[model samples]
Target: MKKLINNFTYITFLGYIAFIPSGPYPISVFGIKLDILLGLVLLVLILPKITQIGKNYPSIFLISLLFYLVTTLLSVIFSEDIVFSTSKWFSMLGYILVSILAPIAIDNYSKIKFSRLFLLVVAVVISFFIIHMALSYGLDKPQRFYLGFDPTAPANYQSDSGVEDIVDPNMTAIGLTLSVIVYLPNFFDSHHTKRRKTLEILAFAIITFGAFLTLSRTAILSFSLSLVLAFTMLSISSKSIQNILTQISKLFCLLLLVMIFLFGIYTLSPSFINGFFARIENIESGKEDRTDLISDTLSIFFSDNKNILFGQGYHITNPHNEFLRNLTSSGIFSLIAFLFFLYTLYFCILKKIKGNYWRYFSALSIYIYIYS
Candidate 1:
């Protein structure tokens, strides 16, 4: 039984890694969307071994979530498209619940370590593809030597689902950045070999520079922030500092190599660079600022009667900002509960003497959650 659970863990983690760039669109496999994350979440939550069926949560939270769920049902009842609203509401809730529950279920360091390895493997695979994409297609269209081999977006346009949302150069760049930066916490541990450490840092630089090639203001900003937050979150013991300096030297060497790669990319493909520059012009025009979406979200939030406690059932589920998206979707009660969860996580990792990569992951995960 334990071995089965262990197998389930690896399968779920690998499935998550596979799904990230796999268009998140449901493919009709036996007439169903082959979404592994949703399936695993259901499996874990339902398996009596995964969670205690009658285990108590605070009544206050239960009552609040129940009330909000009812309100969401009301929204669906009043919605112009009942089916859309119902599906969207449940889908959004399921996502929030999974993220919370995944970490909660890891009962020990071994599980956390296993989870980190899963994410790290994903990072390496994504880094290689990002490198290939930069060299061959340069994010103009995201082609490569392997996998879905076409210099076009993976998403099939006919679906009209959000997956069909254009895989813009910046979005591709951001996806690669997620692959690298998510592993930042793994760097500090002495367990990572010198060569492995250098490779990870190199991957981060290439991914970041490739993001620059897309000229995506958000990607650039997010990478810069992810980096800054990483340094801010690091512990500065003398030995740690010395070890980090050693890693930094290797990191710099890796960056130089990527710089050479960038030069080759530019000389070989001016069109990709031109496209990147075009995105820069759009940024200056305030296109990336998302002013319209911001205005709409604020207007809806303020106009609603929901208090901090309940938040009008988080009426605006699809807010442009990720944090705001959650803020207005899960009652403020849920938001705060999650925020407290994040704070406890970050504090445990950043300040607590016993903290390790798991804690650091929790910290950065929260940061990415809010800001990404």
Candidate 2:
């Protein structure tokens, strides 16, 4: 039984890398309409003894999460659509519960290394998808369902499900950025072999290219922020002024190369530049209505101050932002609990995690979640 659970744990870890749900549409297989990877992760967490793999979490964090869950449950009870609210609540609860067990599933440093390798493999797979999509676009061909490819859009489009094997383009871009970020530090690690460094560089370039093809402004912005934060962390952690200067020089050189490359592309393709800039211009002009949506969310929150305690009861779905979604969906109480839990979790991860990779990953994961 333990062996079976162990196998499932490894499978789930690999699934997270290879099959993260990202498509605008979900692919169904054998009548299963949900994310297979997430499902496997749920199972890993459910199996006896699997949850014991990681260090114990803080009692306060657990208590806060429980409080948040209770608030969510109360919101569901008062929800206009009880059935839908309940379903969504359970789904979110399951994800949160299972994710807490991720470190348990990994269980060791070796497993973490394997997970990074798995991520690299996934990056290679994404490169293929990017290439295929680029070819299709260049040929002016219709989207191929088999490739899980969608045309580039200025913003995230609401879709019922994502395709199999390929994630949504925006999510794909985010994932690619995550891969690049994880490896970025290692690329500069002087202790690594020449061959390894070469591979790391290639991987970074490929994943960055994939992100470029996605054309997702949110992903791009978030990725850029993560890079900045990562460099800041590195600089702060350095022991000497010389180390700081070295890091700064490396960052500057990398940015210069990227800028030069982008400039070259802009000069070479006038139409592409016009189209891309036009999308940015549209965003600047507030054509996306996101600001209006945020305004509406604020109005909803203030219209009934009583709702601040118990929320609007799950019927209001389009918050357009995570903080508003938490506030209006589960009330101010839940939002506070959630924020506290996040703070505790981040603190614990930074203090307890043994490896650099996992530490960076935890920070990046939280940043991605809040932004997403």
Candidate 3:
């Protein structure tokens, strides 16, 4: 019985990874839609080891999460649409559940094999998506998939990022960035054969290729910053020659990946490089929608004293900035809770983890902040 439960746990994690890239999430048990990943994660948390997992997580993070949940509930009570607010609150809870459970589930001791399998699965999914996008670009059938969103919407046309069956292209980029951070380092550290590393490098390269196709400035900028940060952090922390060489190899591989990305763009779509630059041009010229979004959100935020404290409500929809979105939707209390939660996760929980785990987590945190 115990062995069966462990097998189920591992299978659950694999299923979650498989579902991540493209999700309609149409499955629901009761009336509540099950977040497949979080559902599996929660199952993993049900074991006897769950107590230790809880203890392993930072106390500050747990406190902040509690506060955040309370604030979300309060926001729902005061919200215009209770249904929407309630749904969002539950979703946030799922996210927190997954975040806390993931580190515990993939920790160094018992579940390390599951962790490797999860990474490999994610890497394969990313590779498949990159191949699909390349074919889509070459054939020029549909510009972008825009999955789970209205294709005919004006906003769809405004954003040139390659969404490719993901809810949002920017989100796709963020996911890919995270996969790169986690797996790329392993490519360096793994004592796998030359052929195996080549395959891994191809996967990483393809992931990078997908990121460029998104043309998401935030994604690109955040990924760049995270790489530099990861490199610097790894370098400073390592005194062993093997560790230092591993860091250097990661940097070299990254640079090579960029070169391959540029060449791929030129070969596949010669004008893509220009389009990417045009996007930057628009941002620089203050023509980007995000600029106006920030301005308008700030105006609404300060428009009323009540909103300044409680928030404009979740239905406002277009904040485009994560912190501001939380501020405008949930309220100042939620925002404070959120900031504290992030601080604790990165500074406390991530820092407490030994080995290259911290490097990957730090990169992920940086990506989340920038993508937000």
Q: Number of the top candidate by TM-score?
A: 2
Model 1: ten consecutive residues of lowest lDDT = 142-151
The runs of at least 3 residues in candidate 3 whose Cα sits more than 4 Å from the true structure, single-residue gaps closed, are: 23-54, 102-110, 113-117, 126-130, 136-142, 145-166, 233-253, 284-288, 314-316, 355-372
- Give me the candidate number with maximum lDDT: 2
Q: For model 1, what is the alpha-carbon lDDT of residue 215?
A: 54
Residue 126's lDDT within candidate 3 is 57
* Model 3 agreement with the true structure over 197-288: per-residue lDDT tens digits: 88876776666666666566666777777776667666777788887888788778767867777877777666777777677677735556
By TM-score, is 1 or 3 better? 3
RMSD versus native structure for model 1: 6.1
Task: After superposing candidate 1 on the true structure, give the runs of residues whose Cα lies further than 4 Å from its correct spot.
Answer: 21-27, 36-82, 104-111, 126-156, 159-175, 205-216, 233-281, 284-289, 296-319, 323-354, 357-362, 365-369
Writing each residue's lDDT as its tens digit, candidate 2 over 236-295 gives 777899978976886688688677766765675555545555555676356566777777
Q: Write the per-residue lDDT of candidate 1 for residues 191-246, one digit (tens) a residue.
A: 88999888766665555554554455566567656554544444343257776675
Collision count of model 2:
8
List the candidates ranked by lDDT, beginning with the highest: 2, 3, 1
lDDT value, candidate 2, whole model: 0.63
Each model's Cα RMSD: 6.1, 4.2, 5.1
| Whole-model lDDT per candidate | 0.53, 0.63, 0.62
Error of 3 at 167 (Å): 3.0
The Cα error of candidate 2 at residue 297, in Å, is 1.6
